[model samples]
Target: MFGDTIAAISTAWGNSGIAIVRLSGPDAWAIAQRQVRLQTGAPLKPRFARNAVLLDEAGEVIDHILVLPFRAPHSYTGEDLVELHCHGGSLAAQRCLELLISGGARMALPGEYTRRAFENGRLDLSQAEAVGALIQARSNEALRAANRTLDGELTRAVGEIYEELTALGAEIEVGLDFPEEDVPYIADESLADRLEVVRQSLADLLERCSSGVILREGIRVAIVGRPNAGKSSLLNALLKESRAIVTAIPGTTRDVIEAVLTYRGIPLRLVDTAGITENYHDEVEAIGVERARAAMKEADVCVWVIDGSEPLHQEDVDRVHELADTPHLVVLNKADLPQQISEASLTALIPASTVISVSAAEGLRLDELKESLVGLVSGTGALDTGLNASSRQVEELRGAIASVGTGLKALGDGLDQALVSGCVGDARRSLSRILGGDRDEDLLHEIFGRFCIGK
Candidate 1:
């Protein structure tokens, strides 16, 4: 499938100024030349853009375009590549792609371009995955994280430890094979120390994996409270827009109203759930209340808004009690009004959770609340060393850490040298797999499957 020249509309299809039709593989230039002719009738130059006239099979004009050619071994897929800069709309690019396909270029599969780049030694597995992350990033932080990985920051870090493990494994193998030879075996203490260092490195990467995943996939925050508790007001205040319907009447928002915003470069999906109350106005209110509960359970953090101006209700205390095991915050809203419920009292009820007083109507002390929300994501403070790790990478790191630990234990216990050598080999293989050393066809398909076509 990779041997066949592949073509795809790389740019978005719309009535814009320009769209890109991309082709890559051995016959990419030939396929594009068959569909387009340079205005000056000169041969296309490598790494240079030339004005071209796109023509149909009958030699009739299709569209005026700019053709950019790239020679093999320097292109994205390390193959001959061509890009047609055509007028942005459905018709022109579609016709150009059809012509290229008819000229022996097959339509590219989803993520096939990036997959080829990975297979052709242009990019490692992690970097290739980052290309997909870059496209799907929801916030600046996510984009930066993806950019770091794509820039080979992750590959460099993993490569350092992988090389170290490889050297250590070699030394251990020599010791095991030449036990009776004059070559001195590495002292058990020295081996333990070296293994400890590698284990620590893997553990640090493992620690950062949670926040890295959150950076790629943003957090979901649910705003939950009883009726007339300024739940919708808090959502609107955080969003800086009246996204949810706000009114003096209770239960104005009868369903979940969600909005996404960037808070300190973090993508936050805020869900304003309907007021939780058993005293329903109708079946709709009951359904809304149920959905609010579901949202609370699914959220990364739940902001339990309490009206500070009003005395505490049974529902408030009951909800607070239920959040004992969940990660939540106590937000006492209506701070602009004369206070009736003290922060001290709310703190006493939920001592583990942070209590912040804010007027969602007046937008008071919300920054502190936002900071608390950001805190819910673990290991976000460390981003300098390529914090982002895909689920597969995370699992591999864990396995490597475990293997290192097992090797250290074997050395300490004075067990067979073969066991220690086997553990070291296992750890090295795990790290290698992360850098795309052992090719697993099924794993490749699953990872690239998430990407959209033409990437």
Candidate 2:
């Protein structure tokens, strides 16, 4: 444990029921001893709370306070700790910290407290990272994922995979060392069977990474279409708010308007871009159109809004090819009005694309659209973010899976077990990386930087 005491107001700085000042270190309790005069009791005992009248160094009364102590190895940070429940006020907490500073404590750094917990081996790397994932989680899916990782769900899964790989490696090593023992060596099918099991697990895990990551980080969706094609209207419909301008005038929206909304418990960042059309009169509008194209390129998926209120134009047809390779949906807007374009005509242009007949103006079929969006994001083994997920795991499952394939192929080729052993060795390192076995220092610093001061 650190010898210097650290102090911070752990509660959020705002009007609340109460605010707490926390201290932990070897001298944590001693530093808090001098600042607040213990008006009603003897020295506070470890793990005990005492109702004491608080006073400044000048013996001036501060507040009626309760002090609790935790002894070394039993407390957070594995050191002596103290917590003072004080009145919830910014200035009051500041004064308390200042008083502590005058006595002995220094301000705690961002995530320093949690860093201490990590130093004390209270949590693994994944669980330590989970503290932040849990804080930033936006969906129930995300919450469940983080909780699972915090509770070691991903760890256990990875462990089972690793153990299988280890066993395979041991079998290969045995054959490598004792080829003359007349013992029956593992056959090609035997290796293939083990390799297939490992590959399936890895492929399944790889499939979920996309959806798992998106749930943890909100999915990016860009809406694109010709000018005045109800792109902004679609954003407003999805967000259920007048977040963007809608007008009869073409190109009214010359830039992107973004809003975050949850669809079926999954957070989505809907980017409503300026309508794409030829012959822009304004330079800014032209730039906005180019940027819209770029956004389409980068988004996880694109939503092409077709104005059900307008006639079919060549712009819609040509623009569809630009996103032909991109995952997209064909959204037909203005279902409330007399449809000028038939859905059949649009379906002829793109067969695989999902066509959602939606009225962004009246909010018709929006729920179905949301569900379609969910289905679009959720893939096979979509339980990536289920109650035991690890969104920030460091291991690369791809290489390990590939190595297993190579090993099996070598065995099939009748190559000696040395080559198989090498592949398995690489696989073991990859799995260990998931458990933060060989994590570098810079990643740790970068992670802790996101934490709020006072932890």
Per-residue lDDT over 258-345 for candidate 1, one digit per residue giving the tens place of the 0 to 100 score = 8998776667889999999889989999999999999999999899999999998878988888997888888999999999999998
Name model 2 segments beyond 4 Å from true.
1-3, 38-43, 181-186, 205-211, 381-395, 409-416
What range of 10 consecutive residues in model 2 has the weakest lDDT sum? 386-395
Error of 1 at 101 (Å): 1.0
Candidate 1 local lDDT, residue 92: 92
Tens digits of lDDT, candidate 2, 323-385:
778778889999899998877878887777788889998999999887777677665547445
**Candidate models: Cα lDDT each:** 0.87, 0.78
Inter-residue clash pairs, candidate 2:
none
Find the candidate with the highest TM-score and give its number: 2
TM-score of each: 0.89, 0.91
RMSD, one per candidate, in order: 2.9, 2.7
Candidate 1 clash pair list: none
